[model samples]
Target: MSHFDIFIGEVTGTALLILLGGGVVAGVVLKRSKAHNAGWVAISLGWGFAVMVGAYLSSGVSGAHLNPAVTLGLAIEGGTKWSDVPLYIGSQMLGAMIGALLVWVVYMGQFKAHLTDPEILAAQPEKEGLVDQKAAPAAGPVLGVFSTGPEVRNALQNALTEIVATFVLVISILTQGLNNEGDGLGPLGVLITAFLVVGIGLSLGGPTGYAINPARDLGPRIVHALLPLPNKGGSDWGYAWIPVVAPLIGGALAGGYYNWVFA
Candidate 1:
């Protein structure tokens, strides 16, 4: 595919990915929404369907490596060119931000309702100058809808969780040939990968919300910080690097493992 196609495909597919995935979280978390408190199972299934739809939509064009980690793994595995890595990642990030913005737009009323609720606002800590970021809790009222935070605030544990979860994800993609060359996922591959994401969420999502995709996490987090919401709390900038860097590490490792062991 041409560079222009790659850019368009990644941007559009990834936007849809974050739109549906983040939308699920908003539905479950926000008050006045019908799906509020629908819980983790809904979230897991929603994300899986999000990936399936996004991949299927863009597979023919950009191979639907919507996650930077997936793109990195494909490049390391020789399916994608290293020279194109920046474009792929850049487009994914842009798409993710756009998707996140769309989520906020979709849930604007819910966000206003949730944030302005006196009871909800009362539960949030004062956001004057929270110096100890690492020791901070994982979520604010609506922060969970935008980005992930750990149930436990240990850096090492959080990083390891993201790395391992992402490792399982990328390795599966590599082994299954989900993003092979310009093929991305066939119908079967899309289904398998989508279900695999749900499986990972069910099994390993408790600790750190299973941020296996860098763009999925970081792009929305950036949007969270920028969007004008009342009592939105801090963006947890200190914990943000793990979701971005660890997944890249996981993807690189998965690619190396495939080259050495699975190949």
Candidate 2:
């Protein structure tokens, strides 16, 4: 693919990815939305489907490496050009921002309703014990609908969780060729990877929200900080680096392990 194809493919695919993924968050988090209180299972499945759709949409062109971690892993494995890394990552970020912006547009009503009605906090629907991020103490300083936060306030544990989960994810991508299909993970690999995301979320998302992808968290967090939603609090800029840096390190480490043992 030419630079244009790579850029366009990733941008469009990633945009759709975040559009639906963030859309799910808004659906469940916003006070007025029907999907409010749909719970974590819904979130995990929604994100998985988002990845599947995004990857399938761009597979022929950019191979749909929508996550910067995936791009980095492939690049380290000699599949993608190092020169193209920045462009791929930049497009993904831009696409994510666009998608998150669209979510705000789609759910503008719910946002106003949630923010304007301070009583919604007391009216929170029951969860089966899952943390309600929008509630007191747990909500911290920011709304999680636009980004991620830890249920527990430990930075090291949060970063480590991201690192370990992302390490599994990138390693899975690197070895997806060895699956039933054959080498290169075909169209089926997108599905597999999407399921992998769900598995990571279901098993490992309790601490942090399992931000296995850098652009996924960062772009929407930026949008949250810039958007003019009523009473929206801090962006939690202090902990932003963990989601971005840990994923890169984890991806690189996975790629190195793949080269050493699996190559």
How many pairs of residues collide in each model? 0, 0
Residue-wise C-alpha lDDT for candidate 2, range 1-263, written one tens digit per residue: 67888889889999999998888888888768999899999999999999998888887777788989878888887777888899999999999899899999999888888877857544433321354334333332225777787777677898889989999999999887633111234688888999998999899988889888999999999998889987665677777888898898889888888889999
- Per-residue lDDT over 90-148 for candidate 1, one digit per residue giving the tens place of the 0 to 100 score: 99999999999999999999999999999777666653225244446445668888899
Global lDDT of each candidate: 0.89, 0.82
Q: Candidate 1 at residue 230, lDDT?
A: 86
What global local distance difference test value does model 1 have? 0.89
How large an RMSD does model 2 have? 4.3
Clashing pairs in 2: none
Q: In model 2, what lDDT does residue 77 have? A: 79
Give the runs in model 2 whose Cα sits over 4 Å from its true position: 121-142, 178-185
| Cα misplacement distance, residue 255 of candidate 1 (Å) | 0.1
Q: What is the lDDT of residue 199 in candidate 1?
A: 99
Candidate 2 global lDDT: 0.82
lDDT at position 214, candidate 2: 94
